[model samples]
Target: MSYILEILPSLLEGAQLTLKIFLWTVVGSIPLGLIVGLGLTSHFVPLKAILKFYVWLMRGTPLLLQLIFVFYGLPLIGSGALTLQRYDAALFAFILNYTAYFAEIFRGGLQSIDHGQYESAKVLRLSYLQTVRKVITPQVLKIVLPSIGNEVINLVKDSSLVYVIGLGDLLRAGNVATSRDVTLVPLILVGVIYLLMTAVLTFILRKLEQHYSYWK
Candidate 1:
């Protein structure tokens, strides 16, 4: 117990960074994804083509590779215009990668709405923005919430990938402690912490789903 207590602070610090990354990624990705999702459904050919290609590239590649590219690959080019700090790189990769996924989910949600709803909104003289906000968004939210919850949970685990960029995330902290003390205790604690985070998030997401279930 003494040894565990001694190592707890470092592990907690790492967990804090992990949480930061996860939260920021969720915040940054969702709105951007909504925009991308709208673009995917737009009738404009060029815009749709670009967004589709962007989504494909992001979803097709491993997020680890994206992290490497953002952190390591970009700096190799002669100009420093694209350089990012370790933490920034990790957040950028995570948000961008997850945005692609969320975009697809949102696109599907948006597409699933009945076409007559749009016509009804038009007959009501509702602007496109008003219609989307007042009528379409609630239904889309209920449709996408489950999918978003899955991604958010995945984000918790994926935050560990920041260690590859030398960000000292939860997994790295545990690894450091284990290597230094030659005990698995810190690693076990790290796993427990991750499980706890996911469990809490699960509870919150369930509540959100229940609240939105009225749309059904």
Candidate 2:
């Protein structure tokens, strides 16, 4: 117990980093995903094909490899390649990966909307952007919130993956503790923290789903 307490601060420092990654990834991915989803379903054939290929590439690759390539490989690829800061690199990989996932989720939500709803929006003389904002966006959010929430929880766990590139996230902190003190308790603590974070997110998203259920 004393040993666990001794390492708590360091673990917390790592947890802060984990949280930053989670929050930033969530913020960056959601809108980007929505845009990609829109592109995938758009009338522009070449644009749709390109976006689909991008999605396929992101979804098909291992995230760890993505992280490695962003942080390590890009710097090697060409003379003018931009080397990213460690956190920036992890953030970039995470946003790209999660955006692909969120894009698919949003695509499913957007596609589920009745075509008649769009016709109705047209009847009201709404522009495409206005129609999306006034009619389609609300419906998509209501439908996708639960799924998006699930991904948010997964992001909490996935943030640990950043440690593969030496970013020292929560899981790595626990690992460091165990390696130094030869104790398993830190791992248990980290697990509990992750569970708590997920639970809170679940609760919030459930409420949001209900709030948007006005359409139901």
Instruction: Give the top-scoring candidate (lDDT).
Output: 1
- For each candidate, give its TM-score against the true structure: 0.98, 0.97
lDDT of 1 by residue, 1-216 (tens): 999899999999999999999999999999898889989998999999999999999999999999999999998873788899999989999999999999999999999999999999999999999998899888898999999999999999999998888999899999999999899999999999999999999999999999987756
Residue lDDT tens for model 2, 79-105: 447788899999999999999999999
**TM value for model 2:** 0.97
Q: Please list the residue runs of candidate 1 whose C-alpha ends up more than 4 Å from where it truly belongs after superposition.
A: none
Residue 195, candidate 1: alpha-carbon lDDT: 98
Name the candidate that leads on TM-score: 1
Q: What is the lDDT of residue 36 in candidate 1?
A: 94
Per-residue lDDT of 121 in model 2: 88
